[model samples]
Each structure stands twice: as C-alpha cells, then as structure tokens.
Target: MSGQATVLVVDDEIRSLESLKRVLSEEFEVICAKDAGEARRVLESEIVHAILCDQRMQHETGVDFLKHVREVWPDPVRMIISGYSDSEDIIAGINEAGIYQYIAKPWHPDKLLDSVRGAVQLFRLQKETETAGIDMKLTPERVKRVVTEKRGAAQQLFDFDRIVHAPDSPLRDVIELGRRAADFDISVLITGESGTGKELLARAIHYGSSRSAKAFVVENCGALPDELLESELFGCKKGAFTGAYQDRIGLFEVADGGTIFLDEIGETSPAFQVKLLRVLQESEIRPLGAQRVRKVDVRVVAATNRDLEAEVRAGRFRRDLYYRLAAFPLHMPALRERPMDIPLIARRVLDEVSKAYGRAVHGIAPDALSRMQCYDWPGNVRELQNEIQRMVVLADNGQLEDRDLSPRIRSSGAPITLRNGHGNGHHNGHGNGHSVGATLKTQIEALERLMITEALDRHGGNISRVAGELGLSRVGLRNKLGRYDLRKGVSRDG
Candidate 1:
C-alpha cells in the first residue's frame, strides 16, 4: 500500500535474510521470511513487487517455493541467490519457477540493488501494459507508440543534444554521425581511447533508436575470462561447466529488442572472437549447454581503445569479426584533439560534482580553465571528470583555482591566453609574434614542435615516455622528431 515497492527476502539463514533486508530497506519496503512457509504467508498477506530467495533451504528448496508462488501469485518478479556450485538445480528451477535472475554468492550491494530495481521496473511495466489493454495482439505501430510514451523521459535524458561540445568541436561531426546511425538498425563499432565516452555515445544511439523502450544492457567483455565472458553474453544452462548451478539469461537475450553495448571487445581472445562473429553474422546464439540456437533481434554496439585493424593485421584478432563489428564505425576524438571543448566539459563536470558532494563551488577560475585546455589529458574525459571532482572537494572558495589542479596538469603546458584581436597570440615565453601572420598549418606545426621538444626535455629524451605523453605511437613520434629535425639529441632507448 505504500509508495515504495515491497520486496520479499526469503532465506533460511537468519544472517543472510537480515543482510539482504538491510541492503534493500533504504529504497524498498523490505520484508523478511526465514523459510518458504513464512514467505508464502507474507506473500499472501502483502503486495510483493519482487522476491529474492536463497536457493538452498532446510525444508524446501527456493525453486520449489518459487514454483508454487508462480502457480498461485505469479506477478512478482522472482530471483534466486545461490553459490556457483548450484548450477544444475538452478537451471531446472529457472524454467519451472519462471526465475527472472540468478544472483551469485557474495553479491555486491550495488549490483543487487540494481537487479532489484530492474525487477521492480519490469513488474510496473507489465502492470501498466495490462491496464492499458496493450497485449501481443497489438500492431507494431501501436506497440511503438505506447512504449515510446512510457520511455519518453529516458529518451529526453539521453538525447543527442545532451552531449556537451562547443560549436566548432571536433566531436560535433562524430555526434552527427552517431545520430544518423541511430536511425538505422545496424551494428556500430565505436573506437576510441579509454574514458573518451564511447559508452555514452552508445547509450545515445540506443535511446535514439526505435528500440528505446526495451532494455539497454551493457557488459565489459574484458573484465571476465573467455569462459565467463561467453556465458555472460551467450547465456549458459546448468551442467554447462564446473560450478554451473542455474540457468542464466545472457545479455543478448536481455537486450532482445534493444541494444547491447559490449565494452572492451578488443580484449577478447581469437577463440572468443569466432563465437561472437557467429552471433553477429547469423543473429543467433547457442547457450553453453543448450542444444538449440535462439534468434535474437538485439543491436550490437561494441567499443574498444585498441587498434583492432592493426590487431587483425598482426594476426592477434580475427579479420572476419573485425569486419562484422565495424559495419558502421565511428571514431571518438581524444581530449587533446578537441581542446576547445575542455572549458565547456570542465564547467559541466564542476556543476555535477559540486551538486553530488553538496559543495558550494560555483565555477572554475579562468586561469585554471586555460591550464586544463593546454594540458594533454592522456586519460581523456574520464580524467577530466576526476580532476574536476577532486578540485570541487579541495576548493575552499566558490571557484576552482589553478592551485587546486594536479601538479602534472598545472606544469605540463605553457600558459595559453586567447585574445579578441585579429593578431594571433604569442607562446613559449617568446616575445616574437611569429603566429601573427602564420598560416593555420604553420601555427599547428609550431605548437607540435614546441610540445615535442618540451616533452623530450621533461622525459629525459626517452622516446617511449614522450610518445605516450603525447598520445602517439613510437614510430609516429620518431617520424615527427625526424620531420622537426629534433632526433639528434633524443635517446634511442625505448
């Protein structure tokens, strides 16, 4: 009856029951039951939105109890929590009990909370559709209209306009391309360095597409081993392997009508690439233990920082898989490549961090902003966000000053001052106004030469260190050094 969704936590162990309750009590009306009988009684008396049950119980297994619940009152979303070793029983229970999700042992509080939230959303969506007389018989147009109505808020939140960039920012072209890509149902490969907001762009594409109403799932492929990664994306049944206890739905299945963003796809092994290539090529996937393949209508949006084309040439990656994923490739410009956008991004990040931490910081000082734009952010947008957050925390006054910036960023680049006059500005502590009548290309070359020389001196002429600092390959750096005629004093050591 309360506004908050009610969740039933059923665990034979009192400690676990209490822990589950504690984790969810802040957001939901959490009710605890020691066993199946107590859970049944509570479910009959209260309106439960979701059920979190422990698989192993003293009297009856959680599966049996949930199966009974499905027969009697099946509206609540059901999830089972068990150790990795309970795969066989859990797999059988999945279909028989209509289990929505399986929580592995030692669940993270945040992840558990996210799962519960998703279940509650599903519950509410189901109820809404039923009440609106929207069923399987509805036409595609009708379904799209209703779903779009329900998901309008999310669409607005992730609209293409939400991506912050200056008018002349290099990212503008990429965003436009991404927006155009969103209109079609095609696989997208977003290539960029880490923290360059590849996932953010992926979200924008998904929300902008016709599949906005469905689930937009994400998985970091590099975080898990080949076996686990395969299981996570392609699903796995009980008895698939050692410790396989429950039937798990893959991210592909979950994002059936929407998009699945696979981050760090380049880190997958060649063997795994073959499997992924099959899924993309055929639009179907076979679970680890299942005999039949299931067709999926999910759009795949994969991202990586690695040069996958180079990897293919080096025989470290499959050329076939690379082609499949890069059907609509979009490259994200690194932070240094889009220096004009830094001031805007920094201001936005400052506001977000200040509000998140309840700080009184109002703005970044002009000098601090200039220094930020001058420094080459090797870590890209993610690094900029972290820097802003730190400055907001350490700031004493209303503004973030240059003193609050990290020492490396503060000392990395020469001071940059933009003037409204037609004459170009001076740099490198030089009084000669060589930039006054220099062409754009000449000015760019001058800046590059200065950066490379400074980096070489600061890094003690180490080629590798200077190359990394400037976001260039060793060979590319060497070529630049040769062009600038500065390789004479540089060390050859890698």
Candidate 2:
C-alpha cells in the first residue's frame, strides 16, 4: 500500500511480491521487502494499515517476523499468504503473529482484494474506536444499557464478550472463564434468566475459541415451530419438504468447524429434542427422509432460561442428552446479584449506545443510579438491557436521569425483602403490607404510570419500546399511554 496506506509485502519470491505490487498499486502506494531485514526498513519508513506476509522466509519464519512486528511496530492488519495450510509451524504463526486473516496460496485476486478491504475496515474501526473510546467491560448496569440498545444504532456487530473482557475488575475472572469454556469442542450449556446474558456468554465462547475463525451462528429454539426449527438447524435436500425448493445446508453443516448456538434450547419439543440428541451423540445427522447420515465436526453451545434438570424430571428433556450438553455449564449471574457492577456496566452500555445511535449521552446520573440499585431484576440482565436501550432511544436529553429509568425501577419506593440476621428474608421497607404500615399498591401503580409516561414522552411516544420492558404489545402500550394522556411539546430529536 502506497501514499495513503503504504502497504509492505514481505516475501522471498520475486513473482509473488511483484504480482501483489501490481494488484495493490492502483489502490495503495506499494513497498516491497524481499526478506525480514528489508521489511524492518520499510516498517521504519512508513505507517501501514495492512500487511501481506509470506509463510516462509530464509532469515526468519513469516510468523516470527510478524511476532516481532507485533512487539516493535504493530501497525496494519496482519495476514499470512501461505501454501502450507496443514503445517503446525504455520498454525503457530497464526497465534503468535496476531494475524487478522489467512490467505491460503495460490491465491485468487478477488479474494485478496476482499481480504485487504476487510483489513482496511478493521484498521479504520480500530482507529475510530481508539479515538471514540470503545472499552469492552460490562458492569451489570452496562449490560442493562446494551439490552436497551440491542444490536444498537450504527448496525455495528461488536464482540459482546469483549465488552466484559476488557475490564481489570473481579469480573475479568468471569470473562476469562467464559473464554476458556469456548475452547472446548464439547457441548456448553449456559443457564441464566431472561436478561442474564446467556446469549452474550455463548457469543464470547464462540469468539474466544478456535471457532472464532468460522461462522458463529445463533438461533432461538423457542422462536420457531418444530418443522421450521428443524429446517433451520439441519439442511434439507431439494424436495425434502414442501418448502424445500432447493437443497440447503443445515446450520450444523454451514457452521462446520465452528459453533452453532441454540438459544432457549430447553424450548425444543420432545420430538425435536430427539433429533438434537442424535446430533450430539453421533456427531452425525441424517436429514429428514434422507437415508444416509452425514458427519459434522461442529461445536454445539446451547443456552436456556429454563432449568433442564426440571425438564428432565418432568420428562420434557432427555436425561442422557442433558448429561452430554452440560459437559461444561456456565451460570451467568443476575444483575441484582452483581449490583456493584451496575454503574460500570451502565456507563459502558450507554457509551456504546450513544456512539451507535450517534447521540451524546454522557452517562447515567449518579443519584438516578443509586435508586436503580434497589429494585430486584426478576427478568435479569435482559430486562435491564431492554430498559436501557429503550431509554437511550427514547431519551429526550443527553443525560439519562432517574426520571428516564423504567417505571418499575423509578417507582420502586415500595417495600422489598432484605436478609435478616437469622438468614431469613423479610420485607424491610415500608408501605407495601409485606411490612407494617406498608404503602398502598395504588400508590406504586401511580409511580409506575408516571415513569412510563415520562419515558414515552422522551421517546416521542414510541409505544413499541415503552411496551418492550413491560412485555406488553404496542396496542396495549398505546392504551396505557392514552390513559395517562402522555404528550410532548418540544421534539426529543431536535
């Protein structure tokens, strides 16, 4: 790459280096280095956004040179152009060099062009993230914020685990455990409530594992019908079913050598469960009505909000399969259990949401935050995330205030249970009759209405989002808003 990027190609082969120069010259200022020593001189002279290095070199292995580059001058996205795809030494280079992409040689020009473009995109995003500050650490509150801004604004696909991975706090241990869990080729079962981040953990395991190089696919088991779910999970031969117009590779085959995440895995029916069990046990699957079984080396990582032990006891799940899937079980802590992490999590989530939405949400105000810590998150992190995303999207101003929080949280002045010295939990706060002289439910309801009204006003009366956390439909939410007669004069967008 020359001028703007000044790319450096390091290879002992003249033809390889020359061909690259020709392809890259029109787009970048091309610089050539025949060996490691020459590459060093080129690196010292220019700032490169991308590097295309050969796998073999006389003075040093391409991986060793890249490893050195990583320490001394870590610029540009690193790639290995190698013919030896099966070499252990080449694999060693992959990890050591921090290679962004690997191009198996005799390379095609189109693929090379695409790889460079992808590398450039990575470089630009890294630069912007550095300048814009995208630190990946999820305190409970931050995850709550992200739940609100799901997939967030700019349509940016971020490494969700990275959000929890970058922090230096006690949560780092949790993040590391998640990373290690991803490394296994066996089944992984993540258990957590609605918002506790089971899917987030699943994504982390996929990205931090060897499967990071392959497609990390996800499907909610409960989201579709039995036949649809089956079709989605396993590929079908043409005319296998009525809708099977063409032969399609199932997620198991599509995600070969990678991980296929089955979210809400417990939701699958008994018949569907049988198919899943066979896949796990045999590492092979026979498509519907097909006589032959196909072997798949895919990793299975499943998550559920429900307890499989209960499902097994109830005859809803297979006991043998339960044992197989829970080879490694990861329990994601609820947001309430990790209250100390809320402030940080909320800030990180808001930062990401603001950046994604192109808004200027500085952070959650401290006083508003203090009130947020008291309420129990029955729906867990997912609830918090949804609320935060709703508020961020609905927020009338840059600062997220107490009034901007969900009504359930803002109206949490009612009595709540606290642990006693005897280790029994009892109602501590007043006004709810769970305690003496408890507050009226009517009063709590009023506060709830007020909180919802304010969030709706801030969001320009967006019913879909206001109803999101409440688990109400848009039409139902609209009725509530109408009852409150929530209205606005000045536009939040302006």
In model 2, which regions exceed 4 Å deviation?
1-174, 393-397, 414-494
Instruction: Report lDDT per candidate.
Output: 0.79, 0.66
lDDT of 2 at 445: 33
- lDDT computed for candidate 1: 0.79
lDDT of 2 by residue, 1-494 (tens): 11134467889999989998898876665688999899876665444557889988888888988998888766467888888875776677767888878888888888888888777556534433332245563433453344335424322343544544213234556666776776667688888778777777777677667656545677789999887787677755546678865444466654656678888889888888888888887777665544445566778888888989999999999898789889988777666665545555666678778888888787665435545555666776567667778778767777887778777676664323222211122333433323233234432333444456455555665656666755788676665544433333123431
- When summed lDDT is taken over every stretch of 10 residues in candidate 2, the lowest stretch is 416-425
lDDT of 1 by residue, 204-315 (tens): 9999998887767788999999988888887776567776565555677656677889999999998899899889888887778766566678899999999999999999
In the order shown, the candidates' Cα RMSDs to the true structure are 17.9, 19.2
